[model samples]
Target: MILFRGTGAAACRYLESDRSRADDYYLEGGTALAAFTVTDGGGEVLATSELDAEAYAGWVDWIDPLTTKSMGKPRLPGEEGTTKHGSPRFAEMVVNTPKSLSIAAALHPEVSDALDAAQGDAVAEIRRFIALHSVTRVGPRGHQEVVPVERLQTVAVVHKTSRAGDPHRHVHFQIGTRVWAAGKWRGLDTAALFKQQGAIRALGTAVLAAHPGLAQVLDRHGLTLDPVTGEVAELESFNALMSKRGAQVEKNLAAIEASWDEAHPGQEPGPVVHARMTAAAWAKGRPQKRPTTLAHEDGWRDELAEAGYDPELFLQRRLPAHAPIDVDDLKIQTIASRSLDRCAAAASTWTRHTVAEKVTRIVTEHGVRATPA
Candidate 1:
């Protein structure tokens, strides 16, 4: 799954942090050093092809002040990336692995290499999605035009566990919002990325499933991806046990809501208030993370052991001989038909994004297994 969040120069600190510090001081992510630089909070920091000292400086306003027009004023305070207008300083894309893969990698340390290979493939696919869909929106009032300019200045950091310390492998892709287009810097239409998150997610998963390294490794480890749902069906129940983060968040939210209800009798909170309440819950529920706490093989094994789970039992659970449908035989049109039906149930109106997402749903271009960070 891919979760999109609008952030700013702050994310560079959290992702690039190689020391012992959490960048959760405030919502805007926090600031980093002025030096040109750049995670689901992935462990090791990996810069995208476009990221460099200059680009890093550009994002943080340390250098190359961004603006919509070539000769316009530089971006003001709190408007680092929005100098191009309305776009965030960064578009955060959180890429997560399927439940089964997370579980398998958690149990077997050796499976991490496969996960790494898969992550590479997944990153490639995401870049493709960005290149194909993201554009620069420009023009006068009510005469907006979208220009094709697809590329992201991203800093990807790898991580091994969820906030709850579960084997929830994921990647945090902080895409720089400003882009070079039409001979000047402009804001990439991040709304396009945000709106099409669902599509990118599905497309990413499909690509990961088809990835030879990840798929072959899973097979070697007695794990298999269920074609229909795209999860390792055998470990569904086990995977459900690793819902500590979700459980904690929900518990905190409920407690906060109840407390509010107790204090404010007969008064319902507005969306804005409710949102604040939710954020409060999230803040309260956040774990005091070390970021490298569960990095070793024994750490994860001990966790499973304490939970009374025998890792060997998982491998022995086995898989069916072959997939129900030959993956190679699946057609984009067939996938599109089913996806269209599902979309039709929700709304009648459809845009290119809607159709593209439908294709993303069933299109198995490839797959990624996130390695330990």
Candidate 2:
């Protein structure tokens, strides 16, 4: 599953800071920063040495002034309001792995490669969609323009376990808000990017399904496909277990909101108020348990069997020759079509140029690359 969150400049600053403790190593003596970019395309360089913290901080701060600020009052006709600066300058894209895939990655080298391939495919699809759909205004009259994000910079951080010490594998994609377009930097229009999150998630499942061993393992462990969508479900047992902390956070937030409402009377709580409440809830914290006390892989398998999945049948099943569908091509076409349709509906005069330019760029960029699995 892919979870998305738009963050403020302060959050971005903290994420790049030493206090963030993003120091979890994937390899011996290796740093957590896996990749960084400034483009929306697939070309990103993996870090050879340690992450350049100063560069990351600089990038985040450069776009901070461009973030949407509080207006303090309502606007008159033609007056710019909160959205004048566009959306938030930082967003987090979290790609979560299934329990089966997580365990497989830990226990088998081949599975790790499959996981990497699946993750790569998902990320590429996401970037493609964002490139095609990102829209921004160019002039004082709020002229709608399709500013395709040619380069999207991101810091990909992989985590092996959850904060609760559960067996979890996920990648945090810290995407910068600025993109190169029309010979200068522009604030990214993330409305479409956020809208197509479901399609992006489906692409991830489809790509993972292309890996036969991983699919079978997932099936045996109760991450079976939904009959209608062919999308796999996360192991409910594990998901529910790990959601305890989040549930508590939600509960605390609710209580805080209620108290604020009672005190404030008719006034609605704003973003800043909600943010403070959430921060206080997080500060309260949850008890940590050692991972050593968690259930082993075998225990999880046994639990799956007990949950009514046919482990024997899952083991006997052969790998499908192909995925249930052409995930890569289908996703690309879907996003492009959606973007073009929206442009047409909006009576955009630049529709032809936008479509032509985006198509040419996508084809030229991906033509030399191998097809995704």
Candidate 3:
């Protein structure tokens, strides 16, 4: 990252902040600054602000002022080990060199899109891949680690490339500091290491699975995939295209989860196995299979109440001794659980109903099937 004048200076100025500000405030400022410089948000979200367009234009104006044809590409001063044609040899060298003995791939443009899309589906697809492929975890001398969902922080970068005009574009990615299990760090845990390896390999495998046309995609951009590792090759091919035009994609899992909660605010995040097991135990101990036990109704009522359904609602419905029951249908029932719902009912207000609808939408993503009958 060399500091070219003009738009780069503006961007740098935005990054430079008053050191005296509080940490939280300073962070807000930085985010605001980045937002102002990169977005066309139309005055809504900072990250989408229109200032980005202006800053970019200013940058281009500075870089190619006067719009005159030059002898060749302008040389960047003090850049060493680079070709006279101004190729970024230093970056190329770093990426080409193996990070460890294992066949390695640096985050680069050629396969960046597929790499990115792979991560999006990694959680589910990778688990499936690991189960299918007999890939085992490499112990102390391994190439990966899997942090629990709670411990992982993911970031995304988009890579691009081209040949004649655009040249290569690729994304370089770095996973910041790892989180240890149970807060422990810096010890050899081969089992844990292998588990993590399974996860990382899953990510790589999923990328190819999700986007089988990656080689073709690269070819369209004057890039090619490395057949051996199934990755994109050629730095100048992509780098020159994306030099200052690429972007870092943001992963918004937290937002998605929050939306999920809005859909099913009172629903549990884990499996329903325990609830089913308890129901099974109750079913097994019934006498004469009459199924009208006070204990059974009470248990169902209690479970429903705990989950936000009004237990009394179930009582409003008729149940009989040894009635034909669909086991799945008997598993659960719904009622508004939040205090807001209660308040709304008391005041005859409609606002809570709207909020509840929103929350229902959020929770439904977790496999809760609700149908209006």
Q: What is the lDDT of candidate 2?
A: 0.48
Model 3: how far residue 115 lies from native, Å: 7.3
Q: Model 3, 192: alpha-carbon shift in Å?
A: 6.1
Which residue pairs come into collision in candidate 2? Answer: 37-153, 38-151, 38-153, 39-151, 39-152, 40-151, 40-152
The TM-score that candidate 3 achieves is: 0.21
**lDDT tens digits, residues 162-229, model 3?**
11111222222212121123343222222333333423443433244224344344444444344333
In Å, residue 165's CA in model 2 sits off its true spot by 1.5
Error of 2 at 52 (Å): 4.8
Clashes of each: 17, 7, 37
Top model by TM-score, which number?
A: 1
lDDT of 3 at 327: 22
Q: Is candidate 2 or candidate 3 better by TM-score?
A: 2
In model 3, the worst 10-residue window by lDDT is 92-101
| lDDT winner between candidates 1 and 2 | 1
Give lDDT: candidate 2, residue 15.
Answer: 38
lDDT per residue, candidate 2, 1-373, as tens digits?
A: 2222222333433333211111233445534344554444444432222344444444444432223232122222244664443345456677777654564454444555666766766666555555555554454556666645555555565666544334466766666556656666666666655655545554444444454445454444444533223234433334454333544655665677678869997465454665566556545665564223333444434444555546355446533422343334445775587657655765656434455444433332232122342
Question: Where does model 2 exceed 4 Å of error?
Answer: 1-27, 40-54, 63-87, 103-113, 216-246, 249-373
Q: What's the distance in Å from true for residue 2, model 1?
A: 10
